[model samples]
Structures are given as C-alpha cells and as structure tokens.
Target: MGLIHLPTELILLILPPLSESDLAHLLRVHWSLYDIILPYLYRRHLQGSRDSTGNGRNEAKGFFRCIVTSNTAGVQRFLDFGADVNAVISAAEIRKANFRSTGFIPWHDTQTPLNIAASMGDDTLVSLLLNHGASVTGSRNHQDARRAVQPAAVDALLSNHESTLRLLLRRASPLSAPNMERGGLLNCAIARGNLPLLRMLVNEFGADLNATWQEGVYPLNRAVVSSGPEAAEIVRFMLDKGADAALANGGSSNSNGDEESTGGGSQRLLDQAIRHGTIDTLRLILGRGVVDPAIQPLDTGNNIFRTWIIERCTPETVHLLHEHGYFRALDSSQDDTLMIAVRARRGDILQLFINSGVVVDLNARLTRGGSTLLHAAVVRCKPVREAQAASSIRCTTMPSPVASSDVPTVRKIEPEYSREVLSRRCMSEKVEKCAPEEIVRCLVRGGADVNTKDARGISPLDLAEKGPEVVYRILVDSRCE
Candidate 1:
C-alpha cells in the first residue's frame, strides 16, 4: 500500500477535497480513525461556542463544523469521527464554521449558526447543512429574511455567487406571499415596474397573476403607469400568459364574476396610458387588436387627447398614436383624433391637429355638451376646479364670401347653456344637482343660459332657495332671472 492507501488521517491531510457522504462512509468503515479524530473534531468545534451563553453552546460536541467550510476531503475525514451532523443547531457549530454570519433574529433574537451563514449568502455551507438535514426554515436573521426572500434576496441569488434561490426552488419552498411585502412576487414586480422580472415570474415560475383579484386591479393596470415603451409589451405578454381582462376591469366584474360591461377593457388600458402620458406603453398596447380600427374605445376610450389632436394637435405622441393605428380619418373629414386632443387641452397639441388637417365637427363636445375640445380639456385640467377648464375653438377657412354686408352675414352663436353642477355642492336631493350660482355667473359670462334646468326640473333660483338670499341674488344680478 503506497501513498494511495495511506492512513485515513494522512489521506485527509494530503487530499484537497472529499465529499460529505465519503466522510460519513469513512466513519462507518474504521472504528480506529473515529477514536483518534473525535476529540480533535471536538476541540476544533469548541471555538464555535465562545459567543453562545447556554448549555446547548456548552455541549460543544459535533462533526458539523469539520466539513462545514471544507471543499470536500476534510468533511469526510471529520464525519469519520462520528461528528454530530446537525451542528448548525448549536452555538459550538458556529464559531468553527467558515460560512458567513446570519444576522440578528427578530423573533427570539437567538442567532443560530445557519442564520449567520444564510444571511451571508453562502450556498456551500447552506448545502452542507441542508444535506445533513439542517433546519432550513428556522428563524435566522430578521424575520423578513428568516421567513422569506425579498427582492434584495432575489437580486443576491441571481447576481451574486449564491445558489440558494435554486436550492429554495428545488426544495419547493413558497416563493412569496401577500403580507410579506409588495403583495408578494407578481405585485412586487408591478410595484417596482420591473417588466423583465415580471415576464420571468409569469413565464418561468407561473406566479399568480391575479393574486389581488379582489380589488379588480392587476400588475397590468400598473403597467399603464409605467413609462417604458416595452411596458405595453409586458402587458401583452401577461395577456398571452393568461391575464384576464375581467380581472383588470374594476367596472366590468361585480362580486358575482360576470361581465358587467364589454369591449373597452383594453381600451381603458390605452386611455389610462394617455392620461398618464405613458406614450410608449400606449403604442405597445394599441398594437394589439383591442384598439384596431374595427374596434374602438368609443367614449370611455374616446380620449380627450385624441380630440385635441384632431383639432389643434400634432405631437410626437399624436403622430405615434396615428402610426400605431389609434385613429383613421374615416374619409378626408371625419377625423376624431384632433377632437380628442382639444378635449384633452393639449392646446399646443391642437396646433398639431390643425396642421395635420384634422376636421373638427363644431357640435362635437363632451357628453355633458360643452364643445368636444372643452370637454376633453376639463377632464385634463390639473389641480381640479369646480369644472377644470380647458378649451380651443376650431374653425375652417370659409370660402372668402363676396365682400358685402347685404350678403346675409351668418352669426355663429357661442354656446351659453349652463347646467348647475351640484356634484360637489352641499344642496339636498331635490336641489343637489343645481349648479353653484357663481359658476352659473361664469357660464353666463361665457354666454350660458341660467334658465337651463337639471334633471330635477328646477332652475338655478329654485335650487338656491335653501341658501342665503345672496345665492338667488347672484343669479338675479347676472340677469339669469
């Protein structure tokens, strides 16, 4: 027996690495080696107990530390000494170990050896203990890390040298849960706006896309708020991967799980994109068949930006919306794009619509009946007012009429009809819809009719009956009486 068959201790001292199983097998093979190495192993592990205070720390008897930091050979030789395999459970196991320290445990604050190792992201030590059936789920550092891995942990696993992620997954541990943080994985991606990670979780791990379905919301809704061009692409991926329009539609599904409304689910997504100024994401979503010329968002999707672009609009976004097939001229004339822009109050955007030759139907206004541009403008106004105001008048070149007053000059009547908006008013049910007298006065200045009755069939004066005499008096002074 040459050097190849040297004594076991000699073999371990000379060999570079030996596997844990080999060590365990070696222990069973030679009773003599166990006697010689056992005390040595005990002395080596004693160092791990220096910080531990109790008897568990004082016991200081384990084989776990010998193989803990070894590449392989030392582990086998140490195990041959009949070392306690699960030394990670003891303090004596910690000091002798070469793995990183797990942080302070939040629960009992008793930092276990495994806690020290795991927080350091040492995959080898983790593997060694896990192979020896070490407790993987015990409280280690903070409960956050002890119980679960957060984005930071995920980042560490993916970017760092640690292989714990694969280990956790291989062991089939829970990837995430709602209360942990950011509603767990899918929602975390949504909140962080990490499109690529979102794709991975959906396609690779099959994360629950509808985890927060109770709120009638989803990561896709959040995607609309994202600014990236690929944000829409991410949404499309989610839809293809089984994202439900019903799940994203708060207005569509009631608690009963039936379709309450139809057709503009994707349109709402696009409209929200416009509202948020997420043009890139908007283009990507519009590329889907949902916003095809054959199908339109109609009113809910009838964005004010489109209205403005139709009239005085032309911006990179408008051009992009057009190229992306958001709107069609429908003839040389019936373009609704500029109309959308005007209503959206892109007054600067209105210029784009006019230059592009978008036709403005004078009667086109917000559903409540202001000019279309004004309707869109009101909704787009920031720091919302009683009626957030935004408007632009659109007119075309009339064929230069023969220069003569006798030619029956046509006088275009400005819209002056005003309905009191009582949505924010403190008025009672009967008079609640009544517009404020001050707003009524502004409307009057803009040439609105003070006599217009709301659905309640009462004029502004009748609605003001409950107010101080000044309420009725304002309307009267404005000549609304």
Candidate 2:
C-alpha cells in the first residue's frame, strides 16, 4: 500500500524523525505524501530546532542560511509549505548563523526574508520572494511597519541592486508606507544620487514628490546636499514633479498636520547645499528662480560661509556664491566678517574676503567682548602637539597647585563670543597649517591694534599669555604696549 494510504497516525509518527532533505525526497514520491508532509514540515520549520532552554526559536537561522547558500529550491520548498514569510532574523540568530559580518540588524525585530534578499543584492531571489507575497512591509505592527520598509528599500538601493529596489517599489505595501527619517525613500535615492531608481519611484510607484521627513526637510533639500553627478539630474526630475524649491519648515503644521513649511524653505536648502559643498546642487537651486540670488540666509551663530572656508570647500563653490551676489548678504559689519574668519582659523577665507574687496576693520573691537580680531585669534590658539605632550609629562611629575582665593578669576566673556570660540574649538581636532603666528601677522598687516583690549582690559598680548610662546613672540614683536 502507498504511504499515503497508511493510517494518518502512522504517517505523522514516521515523519517527525526525518530531516528536511529526506522529507523533500518523500514529497517527490507521491502527491499524497506532499499534501501530508508539506504542512507538517512547515509546522516544524516554524517551531524550529529548540535549544537546551526549549524556549528559543531559531527559525531565522535556517532562513538566513538558505539565503547565504543561495539554495533557491530549498527556499522555495519552505515557502511552498507555508513558512511565515515575514519572520524576523534576531540578532542572536544572526550571530549563530555567522552572518554577523554582513552587518544585518533586525528591523524592529521583524526583518523578513525579503529584506535579507534585498540586502544580499539577489535580484532573482528578491523577485521570487515578492512573487510569493513576501511583504515589503515586513511586520504587521501598524506603527513600525512603515519604518521597517524604509531601511530595506534603502539597503537595496545602496547595494546598487536596481532590480531589487524596483521590485520593492512595485509593491503597493511599500508605496503606501510613510516616509522615514532623512526624507524617506525618495530622499535616500537622491542622497545616493541614483537617478534611474529615483525616476522609477516618482513615475511608476507614485511616491509623493513633496514628502517631508524629520525637521520638515523635503526631498529637494536632501538632493541639494547630496554629492554625485546624478545629483543634477535628480534635482531636475524633482523640480519637474512640482517639488516646491522654496518650501521651508516654519516650525508649523501643514493642512495635513505634518510639520512642514510653505515659505522660506529655499533659503534653508541653499544653506545646506553650501554646508555640504555640493556646487552642482547649489547651481540648480539658484537657477530655479524661486530663491532670490541676493537673499543671504545668515548662518546665525555660525557663519555657513566661514564654515565652508574652514572646511576648504572648492573655490568654485565659494566663487559661485560670490558671483551670484549671495556673498554680499553677510552682515555688513567688518568686525563680524574678520572675527568670523579668525575664530574659524580660516586665514584662506579671511584673505579671500580681503581680495574680494570687502573692507576689513582690523582694529574693530567685538560688540560684546570689546576684543579685537587679534585678541580673539591669540586667545583661541591651541598649543602645538609637542608643547601639549611636554605639558602632559610635567603634570604627572609636578604637585597639584591648590586653588587660591587671591588669584583673580578670569572674567566670563559675552555668551555669544564665548559660544563661538568654544564651538569652533570643539569642532576642529587637527591642527591647521597656518599657525597663530601667521594669523597674527595677517591681522597686523591689515592694521589690527596689537594692544587692543577687551572690556576686562585683556589685551591681545595678555591673551597671548594663555597660548604658545610663538603666539606671544608674534604679539610682542608687533609692538603690543
């Protein structure tokens, strides 16, 4: 008699001890065996091999192994037998499977087989899974489902698996999901400068071209800050799709009650483009006619132009802004310009300002501290590495000095001035090629007052006491009284 004709109890008892491969052989032997054993195999697969604790499920381990091995037939068998397509790979299972090196993290503890396929850049497997109803929305948690789809889609795009990305986008589930942080799928595509996938998302998937993410940043804003030749094409595509080039986050809600801005957004976009040094993106934004070429968005506490100069952004980017008249939008106060350059330790930008015919008030005292640019530069000068090393050694050998009430406490400078100085120091870790001495000479040549003092009577020479000997020598040689 056929095994199928045997008592159900006999078949169930016999099947429990067989391996997955053995079951596959039996499945081929008869359709009756396939019907009886397939569901049983699926149930066992779902239950997984229990550990000593008998409480843990390693379903994801087998799934991960199947993916790593690219055993398409093995995977198909599991799916055909009704495996939970959306089951998550736990961090523990990932470790056990030796896939730790792949850097896969459980997305909300619900990373599906499809996410793994996408991340592995397996277009065929990804297609196969999607065809089998593998969800792009991995988990069913309504709140987390949307967030989960984003990372998976991003992985496919970042891996340059265009076919996989296209498959995910073709699914209605991913299309219906909300955008995640950093401007969601469209923004992610723009950030990677993937024009073809970007086009597919907009034209085929019907992705909302104007969707905003954290801080109400639009995809256009993200594109403006991204690097790559495809950036220009992506920007054009976004613009063609009726993206608002001037949309700004005014810290208010839109009609949809999502945090978004209808006005003043373009200026912020420009600032980001400058900050990231994307010259092509910058040109695209300016040429759109939404943002006035003359509008200068103040860097506020931190001058974006000064930041660009400090980071040594391409001269073309700086010159483009200057050529378009955006550079003139900076605060007209000469002291502000010079002090910004000095605080940034950007002698290059400072010189650029001078060469651009911008007036430099070398001896002008800051509004709050009453300290000249020279005083600020000297006080902010960090000691050389060798000096710091020697000082560290001396501290280990010398006894600690007790605090004395007789010692005068250094006066706290204005909050803005103190903040600017501290922020610059915290951001830059490496020493610059232009020494404090060179900066001092630059200021002196520009007619800075060598003896200029702040409101507390701290002169440039006095501030030099806190710096290296070279700084002090430069100040003293400049004839500080």
Against the true structure, whose TM-score is highest?
A: 2
Model 2 weakest 10-residue run by lDDT = 407-416
Cα deviation at 234, candidate 2, in Å, is: 3.8
Writing each residue's lDDT as its tens digit, candidate 2 over 146-197 gives 3344345756765567777776766654543454424456766776667888
Q: For candidate 2, what is the total of clashing residue pairs? A: 2
Q: What is the C-alpha lDDT of each candidate?
A: 0.44, 0.63
Clashing residue pairs in candidate 2 are: 247-265, 248-265
Weakest 10 consecutive residues of candidate 1 by summed lDDT: 407-416
Instruction: List where candidate 1 sits over 4 angstroms from the true fold.
Output: 1-126, 129-164, 189-200, 228-230, 251-268, 275-278, 290-314, 319-348, 361-481
Q: Which segments of candidate 2 are over 4 A away from where they belong?
A: 1-64, 99-109, 121-131, 142-155, 179-184, 227-233, 248-266, 277-280, 283-293, 297-320, 329-335, 360-433, 444-481
In terms of lDDT, model 1 sits at 0.44
* lDDT (Cα, 0-100) at 373 in candidate 2: 76
lDDT of 1 by residue, 32-109 (tens): 655544444444555444344522333232333333343344454444444333333323223334222322111111
- Which candidate tops lDDT? 2
What TM-score does each of the candidates earn? 0.42, 0.64
